[model samples]
Every structure is written in structure tokens, then in C-alpha cells.
Target: MNDEKIVQRAIEGDDTAFLNLIQLYKIDLYKTGYSFLKNEEDVLEAIQEVTYRAYKNIRNVREASYFKTWLIRIMINYCNDQLKKKNRVVLGEEVLNFQGSADNYFAMEIQEAMLTLDDRSREILTLKYFHDLKIKDIADSMKRPEGTVKTWLNKALKSLREKLEEKGGKVNV
Candidate 1:
């Protein structure tokens, strides 16, 4: 069955269908969590929490077709909460391993710039660029108009560019 059908079954409290939906989007959830938490342990915790939250509130899903986006938003919100609680960046071995790379400097700059952005701007940029989501998908997930999303994306890119330029010469993030 297609995702929407599976989502519908899950909403109807079908255990197998719910598990299938989680399995289908597990990687996306992991990547989304990892992008924010930047720690495997934290990502795993986030996954568990998101699963519970999704299950508890599955009935609140407004559109079955946008289940992936809804799931991702849950992960993002959980990750953000964890970040707020921690209130500091924790470097993992994954980042340490890249310390010797030539492009690491630029990568670090981009990360720093991303951190400076407001939450909504950062979210729009992440969903648009990192997740490669379409404008319509992001707008639907954010419950904002497409034009508003596009405007936010544009402003985010401009802010990111300015931050990168401040760090060094003009460079694309």
C-alpha cells in the first residue's frame, strides 16, 4: 500500500501499519535528528521520543499525505527542546574525524552561520536544502503560505551568506 494508505491504517490504530510507517521513515527521522542533535546517542533518544509522541498524537495529523513532514517536524521539535536543555554544542567523533579535512574550515563556518539564524529561518533552510523538500511540502508542514516560505528561505539564504562573508571572503553555504 502507498504511504497515505499506511498512514490511514496507522491512524486507525493498526499496530502493524504504524510500525511499517515508522520503519519506512526511520532513516529520515535519524538524519533529521542527527542534523540537530549531532550525537548518535541523542539521535537515538530523539527517535524514541518522536515515536512515542507520534503515536500519542497520530490522530491529530491533518493530512495523511504529509505524514513524513509531520514526522520530521516532531523530530525537529524534540531536537530543539534537547538543544535548549543542553544549551551548548557537543562535538562528536564524527565531527572530530573531519578536523583534518581541507574543507573543514568552510564547513565549520557554515555550521556557525546556521546556528546564528532564528529557529524558523533555520528550519526553513534545513527542510528546503538539507532534506531537499519542495516548497509546497515545506509550506504545508509549516502551515504557512508558499510565498511566505519562499520569502523566509530567501531571507535565510541572504543571512547565511552575510554571516559566511563576515567570517571570511564571500562563500556559498
Candidate 2:
């Protein structure tokens, strides 16, 4: 079934429907949580919490077609809450593993530079690149305007590049 149908089923108290929904979105939700928490344990916890919350609040979801976006936003909020609870400071790319060639090193450097940015900038870059979300989707997920999301993305990329360059990291022209 489609997302709408699955969501309707879930809202009607179908356990299998909710399970299917979780199965479909688990990876994306985990990745979204990882982007914010930057720790495996925290990601796991946030995912669990988000899954529970989503299941519990399935009936409250008005727009069934927007299930993915809605779930992602919930994951984001859950990750933020986890961050607050832990009071952890995640600087640099604590999540990415650099196990490739010289180019990979630079990519890691870029990720580290990205981590130097504020939470909003880092989130914009993560959602744009890692999740490959569109400008409007990001704006909606982040509750920001399209133009504002574009502006933030531009500034974040420029800042990340500058930081990488400052760290003697070179990106291929």
C-alpha cells in the first residue's frame, strides 16, 4: 500500500501497518537522528523514542501523504531533546568514518568544518546533502521560508569551505 493507506491503517490501530511504516522509515530516521546526536547510542535511543512517539501519535497525523516529512521532523525534535538531556557538545564530524583515500580525508575535513557551524547551519547542510532533501522540503521540515533556507545553505557551505581551507584541506576545483 501507499504511504497514505499505510498511515490510515496505522491510525486505525493496525499494528502491522505501524510496523511496516517503521520498517520503511527506520533507516532514514536513524540517519536523521545520527546527524543530530552524532553518537550511536544516542541515535539508538532517539530512534526508539521517536518510533514510540510516532506509533502513539499516528492518529494525530492529519496529512497522511506527508508521513515521511512528519516522521523526520519528529526524529529531529527527539534528537534535539536527547541533546538537551545529555548536554553534549558535538564538534566536528563525530559521526562520519574516514576509511578511504586522500580525497576521503578532505571530505572528513569538510564534515569537521561543517560541525563548526551552529546547529541550524549544520542541520541545513545535513538535510540538504546527506538526506538529499529539496529546498522546499527542508524549509517545511525546518519551519523556515524557502528563501531563508537557501540563504542559510549558501552561507553554511561557504563557511564550511573556508574552514576546511583554513585547516589546509583542499577540495578539487
Maximum-TM-score candidate: 1
- The sequence of per-residue lDDT tens digits that candidate 1 reaches over residues 57-165 is 9999989999998998899888778877888765656667775665886766677677777778878888888788999999989988999999999999999999889
Model 2 local distance difference test score: 0.78
Could you say which candidate leads in lDDT?
1
Compose the digit string of candidate 2's lDDT tens values, residues 59-126: 87877777787888788777666666766566434334546677667655665566567777777787
lDDT of 1 at 127: 87
Model 1 deviation from the true structure expressed as Cα RMSD, one decimal place: 1.5
Where does model 1 exceed 4 Å of error?
Answer: none
For residue 3, give model 1's deviation from the true position in Å: 1.0
